[model samples]
Target: MAVSHYTLPSAKLDKPAKLLIVAAPFYREIADDLIAGAKAEIEAAGATYELIEVPGALEVPSAIGIAERMSNFDGYVALGCVIRGETTHYETVCNDSSRGITLLGLQGLCIGNGILTVENEEQAIVRADPQQMNKGGGAAAAALHLIALARKWGGARKGVGFLPEAEELRIAGELKDNPTA
Candidate 1:
């Protein structure tokens, strides 16, 4: 497994950062483990997080979307477990939830998706354990990296669009005073 070679990304933000953790605890124990791992990672990075629980994985992304639109979180962590079952429901939940999270990320949201689409509970537990795969922590680290990148480049300006309103007004005034020149 590539697990042996995987290294967690180191992150340190320039300013205090707050994150929103949206957990879909349909599998309560798995979710708890994931949340624990994620919290440890966020704390270690010197960041704060607020956690909110939804019904299941399907709702995780929508919760994040709402938070992103109405709240002031710097990043988001999506935690959940979708264990494959006898019915096709597993595929639906897994695909839809993943697609939703991906769409949100594409829209420029800093999100760490820790939702586990596992074949069984054993796999979920193993992946969620902080000492093992620690997928939860990995997700948080991913989000932190994105957040740091956003902070680093988010303020940079290109050309005309970034000109301050005051500067634009000053330029306009100069143009008006020197109409003939």
Candidate 2:
């Protein structure tokens, strides 16, 4: 089958950011390649990162959640490889891991998910290779993009509820003075 790729837009940030990389090295070689690519990408964007290893793909997301709660990382990169096996474990890992990441993202965590769910080792190698699909680098780029967006909108927000006392009094005075009844 033919493959197509579309890269997300990247932008320079106003300040450098820190990222946490949660990797699952069950497939050591593949995880190494993925981590290398992710590091290079983060460096290219003028950001720094810390790497932490978990047991497998399923644990990657939990690690990220822990770091988010306990650390001050600006973003996260999740890297793992789940090759289809003889049983249904592959499906569980792939689905639950992705779901966790998605939930974290919905909660406003900037994350790049590089977990690979492939049919075989060959496919995993092709996708994880920095010189090939470069999924690791792609994940970093995704996180960077999210960080930029968060910073761009990180400012004082206007409240939509009740107005402050001074403004309320001023409006009340105006209404009293302009009464047509």
Candidate 3:
């Protein structure tokens, strides 16, 4: 079988931005490599990022979710590894984590998932290698792309002359300009 490798062109931002990396360090070595690559990519694009550690793969999405709700990160990178074993827990972790991240994206949060799902240590090492697959960098790029898209759509940045709901209703003739009642 032929293997295909794909990468997003480096994302260039229009302005300085902040990102957060939520890493699950079950495998410390692998997680470190992923974070290194991700940070490099983010900085290369003229952006800054803050890093935080979580317990395991399952918690990665939850950390991002909480940050999305209560923090100011412009984007997020999710880094972790889940290796398959004899038990079914691997599938649960991988599936639920991915689903959660997807849900957050659907809600319009920019997120890059660098979590590695592998069948063995060798595969994990190859995928996590900063000089090899560089999935971490890829994830950062994905987040940047989403951020760019959001900015393009004016996410929360209404155009000039945008008005509040009450003003808009009056302008649309939905309400009287001067009402006593």
Top TM-score hit: 3
Deviation of model 1 at 137, angstroms? 0.8
Query: lDDT of each structure?
Result: 0.87, 0.89, 0.87
In candidate 1, where is summed lDDT lowest over 10 consecutive residues? 155-164
Q: Highest lDDT among the candidates is held by which one?
A: 2
For candidate 2, lDDT tens digit of each residue in 55-106?
A: 9989988888788767788899999999999999989999999999998887
- Which residue runs of candidate 1 sit more than 4 Å off their true CA positions? 1-3, 156-181
Worst 10 residues of 3 by lDDT: 155-164
Q: What is the lDDT of candidate 3?
A: 0.87
Q: What is the TM-score of each candidate against the true structure?
A: 0.83, 0.83, 0.84
lDDT of 2: 0.89
Instruction: At residue 69, give the lDDT of candidate 3.
Output: 63
Question: How well is each residue in 1-181 modelled by candidate 1, as lDDT tens digits?
Answer: 4555757558879987899999998988888889999999999999999999999999998999888778788899999999999999999999999999998887778899999999999999999999899989988998998899888887522221234666566667865665444
List model 3 lDDT by residue over 1-181, tens digit each: 9998666677767787799999998999999999999999998899999999999989988888788767788899999999999999999999999998888787778899999999999999999999999889889889998888888778643222236677677767877846432
lDDT, residue 122, candidate 3: 94
